[model samples]
Target chain A: MREVPVGEITKVVRDLFIDANINLGEDVLVAFHKALEAEESPTGREILDELLENAKIAKEEGMAICQDTGLAVVFIELGQDVHLVGGDLTEAINEGVRQGYQEGYLRKSACHPFTRKNTGDNTPAIVHLEIVPGDKIKVIAAPKGGGSENMSRVTMLTPAVGMEGAKDFVLQRVRESGANPCPPIIVGVGIGGTFEQAALIAKKALLRPIGSTNPDPELAAMEEDLLRRINNLGIGPMGYGGRITALAVHVNMIPCHIASLPVAVNIQCHAQRHKEKII
Target chain B: MAEAKRIKTPLTDDVVGELHIGDRLLITGVIYTGRDAAHKRLIELIDEGEELPFDIKGQIIYYVGPTPAKPGKPIGSAGPTTSGRMDTYSPKLIERGLKGMIGKGMRSQQVKDAMRKYKAIYLGATGGAAALLAKSIKKAEVIAYEDLGPEAIRRLEVEDFPVTVINDIYGGDLYEEGAAKYRRQ
Candidate 1:
């Protein structure tokens, strides 16, 4: 087995978290430009301009893109052939978050649910670890803000509803979300998984580049149809009203119990902050 | 949507009366900032019949919890958080003579009803455009709840801060109107 020092994991997490907050991903920027060209409403077009300018200033000044830098969400694919050494993996990850939030000057938004007390240093990152076949570890850090996250939802559907039911739920959520999630949002839907699995898969779908086609032809078509329908809702940028409400809709599907049809909708704002590294 | 009107802080009835939904405006002068945590504290003070940190009359409160300003900048990425979360507290504050609020998203009907009765208006700043919005804030100073970190209340001196009216005393709701205008299906 190849032994990998856990310190390296900490370092990777720290850098990825910081990088994700400061830099808006290239895919999101391209979507903004594309939306700007296609957007029809005057207010929608101007809001897109402001979003693009915000991205530029955040990059040039080395500042966190938004005040709500968000909770540090780490996804790790641990290889079966590798043995982690030197420290506890969970502790290493949390240390990285504490360091990143402090050094990056990003907001530490994690807090006690009832007391509403700040955790001080964004600690105890939501870490999702998966055992995989490779000898190398791959990690992704995505900072998810509260506004968009608050609007995401998960539900179990009867098999009778099928795709039509799924589509309706997705559309309703976006319509109700309106400006709350910060419009020009990305809608990630996970279908056919268990309760928690559906939510996880839906969130992972957001890690995919905006507007990229799904590998499965069936899923790809649904993604396109959903994207078109969501944008047609005309929530527009900042919900000021326009032709471009959503940047894209991405769907991920998996088989489940014959009786169950679980659906999850994960909404992502235009900031679209994420970074990945394999080591 | 004529040329953006110029608004100074500590708003009065004349200015509030003239502003309409969808009207763009550039606000200059001092405005105070607070979000959910600080707002809860302010409301508790009101419940106990204690004095607030700042006077409420004619003042505009911005719903934002900005990041710490790096050196050489007055504030870091200042942008509006979702306004719905403050619905519970806004009515009480609005009744106390608060004239305007800057935020993004739809407000509760209760908040709107209060706005209509209290002669206040809701404004929308481009959400997620924090880095750009920080440019308008010339200065920032935390005035209360320093322990709340980003959620602390701060006083900001700003110039030409851009926003659009979302709710007005005449009962205009921009979010509803804006969406209906664009909904094709």
Candidate 2:
């Protein structure tokens, strides 16, 4: 059995949180440049320029790209043969998040839902774990901001609505969201499976880099078609109206029960902060 | 929507009236910061007829919940949050003489009507441009709701803070106007 120390996990999670919050990924930067070339609105182009400049400043200063800093979301894939030693796995993850937010000077945004009380430490990360075949663990950290998360939607469709209905629904969510999710946004679509599973995969779809295509030809075509249609909406950058409204539309689908046709749309801002570590 | 006009805060009816949708701006002077939590608390104070922590007359309240400052910096990444979140409380604040708002995103119809009626304006600062925005805020101090953490109200001194006029006193909206001009369908 491969043994992994919890302290090792803790240190990795802490560093990942800080790094992801500060650096705008290279794929997103390239997408911004491409969007800048395609965008028609002068203001939209200007906004894109400012976004690029902000990314540079954040990196140089070692500051967060956005003030929200976000709620910590960790996706973990653990090997069946691996043995976790030295501490509880979940607590170690939260401890790392606590130290990261405190030392990095990032904002502690998690709060009690009803009472609206601050969690203070930014602890209790939203952790998703999958047991895989190998012995190593792969952890992906994504800090999701409230604005884009607030715009995400999930609805079960009638079997009659079909794929076309799902596409239209995704478009509608983007249209309704407009500038709220911070346009030139990344759209993560989760299709099929049970209702909850659809939502989970929809978020996971965001972890894929901007230009990658789905292995399924049909789904790949859908992603391309959606990207074109969304940008055609003229929502522009930051909703001021332009040719490039969405940076990318990523769709992930699975076979659902015959009775179910569930879909979830998770919108991500241009910041697109996520990092992965494998051990 | 011609050239941008340089404007200082604590705006007046005369200056607010002259601004139009799509006009760019460089706002200078002092502004107050308030977001969801602080807005709720401020509205509560208004309903109770208790005094606000700061004077509301002719003041601009930026909708931001900044990250905590690192050493040697006055404020951390201090960009605008979604202004639509402030919609419910904004009109009431406008009614009480809040002159301008600096944030990103759309506003509710009620908030727009209040801006027109009250001779106020809404300015759009580029969203996600937090680090650059921080460079404009020369100073920041928590002025109220200290326990609210990032949501605490802050009084900020700003210099040449860049923004675009999205909603002007004359019922003009840049989001609608700018988008309509370039929309193909």
lDDT of 1 by residue, A1-279 (tens): 999999999999999998999999999999999999999988888889989999999999999888899999999999999999999999999999999988888888999999988888888799999999979999999999999999999999999998999999999999999999999999899997689999999999999998688999998999888888988887889998889989988898999899899999999999899999999
Q: What is the lDDT of residue A192 in candidate 1?
A: 79
How high is the DockQ of candidate 1?
0.82
Q: Give candidate 2's whole-model lDDT.
A: 0.91
Model 2 regions lying over 4 Å from their true place: B1-3
Question: Which CAPRI quality tier does the interface of model 1 achieve?
Answer: high
Q: Give candidate 1 misplaced runs (Cα > 4 Å).
A: none
Q: Which number leads on DockQ? A: 1
Model 1, C-alpha of B38: deviation from truth (Å): 1.3
TM-scores of the models, in the order given: 0.98, 0.98
Candidate 2 positional error at B173, Å: 1.7
- lDDT tens string, model 2, B51-109? 99999999999999999999999999988999998999999999999999999889999
fnat, candidate 1? Answer: 0.83
TM-score of 2: 0.98
**A24 Cα displacement, candidate 1 (Å):** 0.6
